[model samples]
Target: MKPLRKIIFPAAGLGTRFLPATKASPKEMLTIVDKPLIQYGVEEAIAAGMGEIIMVTGRGKRAIEDHFDISAELEANLKSAGKSALYKEVSRVARMAEVIYLRQKEALGLGHAVLCARHWVSDEPFGVSLADELIIHEKPAMQQLREVYDQTGCSVIGLIQVPASEVSKYGIVDYTTEEGGLLRLTDMVEKPGMDEAPSDMAMVGRYIFTPRLMQLLKAVQPGKGGEIQLTDAIAVLAKEEPVYGVLLEGQRFDAGNPEGFLLANAVIGLQHAEYGESLRKSLQEYL
Candidate 1:
């Protein structure tokens, strides 16, 4: 098995939930505390030992590119102002990794976005991270899945046990067996009804997929809303080969929506070293 040195970030969605804010900006560029959501995802991938970033972006997402690029003029200004700390931080972001951009060209779906990266990811197992789903943990969530892929030489997806009432909101996993805390997935169902859900282990957005999955994704037909679904390809992959799901030990925030986005800001804000105490005091006074 090849080392997982590359990861794909699907950032093509229009972010309809954010309304006017997203109307002019990419949702992945929205800040949680001080860092944009996509930066956190990129940092997580780097911490996991992945050095190459393949971003599947679309129109109106130029800010995402600019964020990772070096701003020579801004850096010079910061240096002249004696803001060395801020200057170094900005320079660090530009050198984070070799980020390659690919245009999805359409608001197709997650599968289509991943498919757009096939040329760059050719013949190598790659990781996929949805920036909107932020997973906070001591160990990078992508690294956790990569460890499983290292052991089994198969695909691994991050899982979070959701409540029964929320099973309809995610792709629930059907497993044949559980060993050492990893579920051997037999199949996956997208947003199944309460009674039809196979398990509470909902698939989170982090995934380490074998190159075979790329082929599977190519054959996937468009599902609901005429969009190709990644879950559909994963379901087929489960039947053909071993695919595992590991319950991620972390706090996950679905920053794709307003409620979760606000909660993430508050929760992560309270954990920020520089502003935690002051923010905590302010929250107490406001509440």
Candidate 2:
């Protein structure tokens, strides 16, 4: 397993739950503190030594591309207006990596969204991160998985210990073995009920996969909600090669859901400079 040089971000979802805000904007453009959700994922990929980033975007997602590319007018206006901090934020994203954009023509499941990037990923192993699922820590989530892949020469995932009652909300793993904190995966089930779940470990935002996983993705038919399931692809790859999970040493927040989004803002806001004191003080009054 060479370095995880390429990463794929699936950002094609219509974000129906977040509309009418999402009606004009891609949900990935929603900010956590000062940064958009997609930038956070892109930074994680860069931190993990990923060289190429492939974003599978869709309609109304041009803003996603523009957010990362060089913005002449915005940069000029900021410079003239003396908005140094805003300039820094926009400029930083522009230089992150070699970002490639591909449009997913239709709203597909997570697995199908990933398949849209097969050409960009080509024959090499790639990383995957969903912007909706934000993992906050000093180190990025994909960086942890890359370290695991470095040592084991196997596919790695960032796993979290979810409550048994909530196993139905995520893809749970069957823990086969554990060498320290990393668990070797034997099986993966998507959205299993509490009683049916093999383990409490849930697949979160980060993943490192072998090129063979692409083959699995191509072969896997759609499951559950008529969209190809990423879990199903990984399950096939598990039988052919070892796939392991690393318990991410960080907090996980899902921004896709309403409650989770507010929680993310609160959690990140508590630590941010631009809004921390004000946000905390304001929220404290309510509490």
Runs in model 2 lying further than 4 Å from the true structure: none
Alpha-carbon local distance difference test for all models: 0.94, 0.88
Residues 98-159, candidate 2: write the lDDT tens digits: 98899889776999999999987888888898889988888878888888898888899888
lDDT, model 2, position 98: 90
Q: Against the hidden true structure, what lDDT does model 1 obtain? A: 0.94
After superposing candidate 1 on the true structure, give the runs of residues whose Cα lies further than 4 Å from its correct spot.
Answer: none
> What clash pairs does model 1 have?
none
Note the clash tally of each candidate. Answer: 0, 0
Q: Per-residue lDDT for 1-287 in model 1, tens only?
A: 78789999999999998998999999999999999999999999999999899999999999999999999999999999999999999999998899999999988889999999999999999999999999999998998988888889999999999999999999899886665766799989988999999988899899999999999999999996799999999999998999998889889999999999999999999999999999999989989
lDDT of 1 at 159: 92
Cα displacement (angstroms), candidate 1, residue 282, comes to 1.5
